[model samples]
Target: MTIPPIVRQVVVGASASDAYAAWTRQIGTWWPLQRHSVYKQDTSVAFVDDQIVETSSTGETATWGTVISAEPPSSLTFTWHPGHGAERASTVTVDFVPIGADRTLVRLTHTGWEVFAEPLDAREEYRGGWVGVLANLRAALPPSSGGAEDVWLILEAAPGLAATGSVFAHPLFAEHLVFIDKLKADGVLVAAGPLPDEPGHGQTIIRVPASEAAGYIDAAHDDPAVAGDLLVLRVRPWHVMVPGV
Candidate 1:
C-alpha cells in the first residue's frame, strides 16, 4: 500500500519575501536544533552551497539534504535524509503565498514515502513532527503590523574597534555579510557600499514599511559588526524627492 505525502500549512506575519527568507536563510536561528538536530545538542543548521547541513559545536557535521529547486518568495524544494544516506532520501517542498500586505501562507509538502521500509509509520511520525516545526517557524517571524506606507532609511556606518583598513579582514565581517544577505533575501536592501572618494565612510539603503521601521533597525543592531563593536551604525530616514530620475 502506498502512503500519501504529508501536507501542512501555516500563516506567517510577514511579507512573502520576508517569510521565504526566514524559512531559508534565517532557519538556523529558529530551528529547535537542541532536540531535532543530528547531534541533538549545540548544533546549528543551515542551507549552504545547495545542501542542508547541520554542524555541531564540536566540529561534527551532517548533511540533511540537497536543494532541488529554490525560487525566492515563491517555492523551495529539497531532498530529506537526516541521519541517513541519500539512498533513503525523501523530498520536501515549501511554497509561500501572499495573502495580505503583511501576511503570507506557507505550505509544506513532504513526499517520497514509498522509499521507506515502512512508509505508513514514517508518514505518521513526520505528520506530527511538521506541526511543531511549522509552529516554531511561524512564531519566529515578526507579528503583522499592517501598513502600506514605505520609508527609506540610510545607514551610516563608521569604524569602531576595528580599524578602517582591517575592518574587512575581521571575523565579524563574515557575519555582517550574512546579515546583508538576509536583507537582500527579504527584499529590503536597496544598495550598500562605501563612498567613491570618502575613505572609511560606508552607507546602506533599505526600504521598509514605515510602521515596521523600528524592527528593521533592531535587526541592523544585531549585525555582528554592530553588535561586536566592530562598526557603529546610525540610521536616519531618507526623503527621496527624485529617486533615480
Candidate 2:
C-alpha cells in the first residue's frame, strides 16, 4: 500500500528570499533544539557537509538528513533519517511560494514512509512534529510589515550591573554589536544605538508584523548578551508617526 505524504503549511510575513534563507541558512535559530532531534540532549543543529547534523552539548553528533536539492527563494529537498540510518530514510521537501511582496507561503511535504520499518507509526510521529517545527519557524522569522505600523524592542542592563561602569568596555560588547549588525542585515532592525549616558540602557527599533511581536521580543531576549547575563531586556510596542521615506 502507498502512504500519503505528510504536509504542513504556514504563511510567513517575510519576503520569499528572506524566508528561504531563514529556513535553510538560519535554521538553528528557530528549530526547537530540545524537542525535534534524535538525541534528547542535543545542543544545536546545523547543515554541515551537505548533511543536517545535530550536535550535543558534549560534542556528540547525529545525522538527521542529507541535502538533495537547493533552489534559493523557492524550494529545497533533503533526505530524512533522524534516529535512523540512511537505509530507512525518507524525503522532505519545502517550497516557498511568494504570495505578496512581504508574504510567502511555506509548505513542507514529508514522503517515502515505506522506507521505515514502522511506517505508520513513524508517519504519525512526524505529523505532530512538523506542526511544532513550523510554528517555531514562523516565530523565528522577522515580523512582516506593510508600511503602516512599526514595532521596536528595548534592552537594558540588569539593575546592579548598569552601575558597574562603561558597558561598552565589557568583553561581550563587541559580540553584541556584531549580533545587532546581523539583525540590521536581516532587515528587521531599523536603528540601534547605545545610550552611553544612561549607563545600562540601549534601544533598537525594528519593523515587524504585530502578529509576530511576541516572537520578536523572544528573539531579542535570545541575544547572546542577554542570554549570557551581560544585559537585560524590556520590549515595548512602538508606532512610527512619521516614518522617513
Candidate 3:
C-alpha cells in the first residue's frame, strides 16, 4: 500500500504546562530509543524540545520532528524521520485539549510519507511506531500539577551509588514521596506526585513560590533518601505560576 504516502489527524489532551515542557525538553529521558531507534550503532539521544535526535555510528541519524506549532499544556506539531539515509521524510502533529477535570485529550497524526523514495518501507516502519511513541508521550503528560514547585526533599542515601553515575537506580520515588509528605506537613507543597510517567524516569516538581526555592534545594540535600546525587540537580528559576490565567 506504500503506507498511503501520508498520515494526518488531530490530537487533544489535557495536561499541566510543566508536564508538556518535560515532554519537549527532556524527550531522550523518556523516548523508547533502544527498541525503536533506526541507527545501526553508536546510538545517541539528544533533545531540545525543538528537536529530538537519535544518531548512530553508521551515520544513519533519526530526527524525530520540530516544534512548528506549540501551545504550552495544549498542543504541539513536529515532523518525523526514520533515518538520515531515508529517501523520504514525514510530519507528525499532536494536540492536547482539556476534556474534563484534570483530564486532557491527546490527538496525533503523521503525514507526508509519499515524499520518501520507499513509501511502503517507510509506512511499514511506522505502522505501529506512532502507537508506541505516542503512548509513551501521552503517559508522560500528567493530569495535574501535583505541586511540583512547592516540593522539598531530604536525602541520606542514593541507591546503587556508581562511579560514573550511569545507572540511576535509587530510592527516587520514595524520596520524593517523603519530601512531598514533609511539604504537606509544613503547608509548603500544595500537591505532589511522581512523574516517572512523562519523563519515563524518576522526576518530581514543587508548586511553591520562587523565593522559596533556595531553601528547598538545601532541605532536599538534608533528606535521607536522595543525598548521594545532590550535585546532579540543576535548579532553574520560573518567572511566575498561574493555574489558568
Candidate 4:
C-alpha cells in the first residue's frame, strides 16, 4: 500500500486545560527542536520564550503558525510552513483528551501534505517526529496539585487514624491526633484521611519535598497508633512525579 502524502489526526493523552497549556503555555518546555527543520538544525517546533516563532543559521529559515482552534484539553490546530518556501505548507491539528485520573489522550494530524512532493516521505518523517514530539509532551506535564512542585508522596492508610475508628475513641491516642494535625498545618502534608471502609480503613496522599519529608516521617513514628503497634507497614518513598529529580 502507498502511504498518503498527508498525515491526519495524531492523538495523545492529557487534560483539557493542560491540552491548551501544552500548546500555548507549555509548548516550549517540552517540544523537541532536535528533530525539526530543513537541515535538522532549526529551532522552531518549540522553545522556552513561548514566543520563539523561528530562527535559522542567519536567514535561511522561517516558521509560520498560529493556533487557529483552541479549546484546551480538547483541541488545537495551527498552520505550519518553514524554509524552502514551498508555494504552500501543511496545517497541523492536535488534540488533548482526558483518559482517566491524571492522564490525557493526545492526537496530532497534518493536512496539506500534498503540497510536498513525497507525501509518503512526509508521513514517515512525521511518524518519527511525532514520536519524539509527543514524548516531549509527556515530559512537560506538571506534577500533581495542578502545577509543578517538589517531591510528592501519595499515601494510603487505614481507619485507626480516623475520627470515628475503633482506636479513635481512645483518648490516649492524643499523640496521633497531635502529630497528624501538625503535619496538616505545615503544608508538608498534601492530603490524608481514614479508609473509606465502614470501619474506616482508607488512604491519603502527601505531596512534599525531600527537604521537608524528614520532619513528617520522623513525627509519624511518635503517633500513638504507630507506637501502640496498631498500624503497621507504612510504605514510604521520596517520589519524583516529573522526573529529572
Clashing residue pairs in candidate 1 are none
Between candidates 1 and 4, the one scoring higher on TM-score is 1
Give the candidates in order of lDDT, highest first: 1, 2, 4, 3
**What TM-score, computed on C-alpha atoms, does each candidate reach?**
0.59, 0.58, 0.45, 0.46
Alpha carbon deviation, residue 59, candidate 4 (Å): 9.1
lDDT measured at residue 215 in model 1 versus the true structure, 0 to 100: 67
Instruction: State the lDDT of candidate 3 residue by residue for 87-131, as single tens digits.
Output: 454677655543323433344555676787776566556645655
Any residue pairs clashing in model 2, and if so which? none
* Better structure of 1 and 4 per lDDT: 1
Tell me the lDDT of model 3 at 122: 66
- By TM-score, the candidates rank as 1, 2, 4, 3
* Candidate achieving the largest lDDT: 1
Candidate 1: global Cα-lDDT? 0.78
Per-residue accuracy of model 1 over 1-245 as CA lDDT, tens digit each? 43445655665778889999998898999988776779998789998889999998999889999999999989999999999999999999998876435766677878899888988678778866876888788789755666677768777776653544567787887888898889899998999887767656588999887656656765776787876656666565677667772
The global C-alpha lDDT for each of the candidates, from Candidate 1 onward, is 0.78, 0.71, 0.49, 0.51
Model 3 spans > 4 angstroms off:
1-16, 40-44, 55-62, 85-87, 138-245
RMSD of each: 18.7, 16.5, 15.6, 17.8
Write model 2 residue lDDT over 121-176, tens digit each, in one string. 88778867887898888877644544343444343344222225556777666767
